[model samples]
Target: MADTEFVIEPGRQDLVMIRMFDAPPDVVFRAITDPELIPRWWGPHVLTTRVDRMEVRPGGRWRYVNVDAHGREWAFSGVYHAVVPPERYVRTWEFEGAPEEVALETVTLTEVDGRTRYVAQSVHPSVEARDAIVRADGPRGGRESMDRLAVLLGTVADM
Candidate 1:
């Protein structure tokens, strides 16, 4: 299993995550941007994710909701700022529960020895906001999500 490395510096408003995938960059990129594949690996294994809306293009908007076994829901929405296929994408992410605390996120995919190196950086409005997310078990959720994605990529690459 690939481990997700998180970089959280003191007093910093940004969080960086790095992970390696066994699939090629294009395969990894498609798994992330394709709405059909998103639900398969978007969040924690216990939660079922639904992509309400997703338009993978510049200026497009996207939204997804994750429902737990107890019927609880967590909704997240974002707008794409830049969309470069098989390479990188920039977007703004906001969780509905925390209305105005938005984070500008950049996801980059690089080819490393025929595999993909995934790097994501999320910049929050303030250091406090970033810290709040960390306190909310964000890193654990992220790690789980990436782990799920890695599994999906293995199946996807086989196809």
Candidate 2:
């Protein structure tokens, strides 16, 4: 598995994450957009994820909740702005705990030598907002999620 790289530039309100998967774009895309498969690899290993709502089309809404061992839940919700299967999608992301700090996120998957290169760009409302996420170890969570996704892709690559 390739490392999940995060690009955070100074004075910028956006962050970009890149990772490579040993699977085709279609397979990778399916693994990401399929609600049934999401809970399998959507968050940290210690948390159980549940897809409360997922409508994978333009103007559709999606929500996911992660529950810890102690039964504490963290929810995230978003609305899809654009959707192109196996290629890209743009959406808004907001943690229910801090709804005011919504961010616009664009995810793109590119084919590279038969593998998939996944890139996600998240634009926050301000530099402070972006910095806050960094301070909160958002990248670490993202890395863990991607690591899980990679493992899932390996299992479902032939499906």
Candidate 3:
């Protein structure tokens, strides 16, 4: 498989990230939604993730925290709007620090020739909010996170 190229495109009030994985849709989907697997690859390498709560079902609530090496924690929470295993999921995402700036995120996984194309679209309440996420180096973090996911998937495959 080729190297995964992560692309982040910002629209009027939304941001889209595209990444290709060497694994199938089911594998990639589990990597994202599985609570135990999430702590292994959800954040940057410099941080440790803690899943406070994760319920992957319609109307379910989830929360997670990532603590950097320095012990500074960043927390995020969301509510699942829809869940279609190995295919798509929609949720409302909110950073605990800025809860008012919530975004509706939809993640889709499509398998093509045994590979999965993962697309995440985050629709913010306003253009400025979406731009703020971009300015916060969200793209870099996202790219790194996905790269980590690939490595985790390799290990999961072995298991």
lDDT of 1 by residue, 60-100 (tens): 99999999999999999999999999999999999999978
Q: What residue runs in model 1 are displaced by over 4 Å at the alpha carbon?
A: none
How high is each candidate's TM-score? 0.97, 0.98, 0.93
lDDT of the structure predicted as candidate 2: 0.94
Candidate number achieving the greatest lDDT relative to the actual structure: 2
What digit string (tens of lDDT, one per residue) describes model 3 on residues 1-159? 344444445558888888888889998998899899888888777789999999999999999999987899999999999999989999999889999999999999999898898899999999899889888888777778888998888887742
* Pairs in clash, predicted candidate 1: none
TM-score of 3: 0.93
RMSD for each of the candidates: 1.1, 0.9, 1.8
lDDT of 2 at 98: 90
C-alpha lDDT score of every prediction, in listed order? 0.94, 0.94, 0.87
Tens digits of per-residue lDDT for model 2 on 36-153?
9999998888899999999999999999999999999999999999999989999999989999999999999999999999999999999999999999989988999999999999
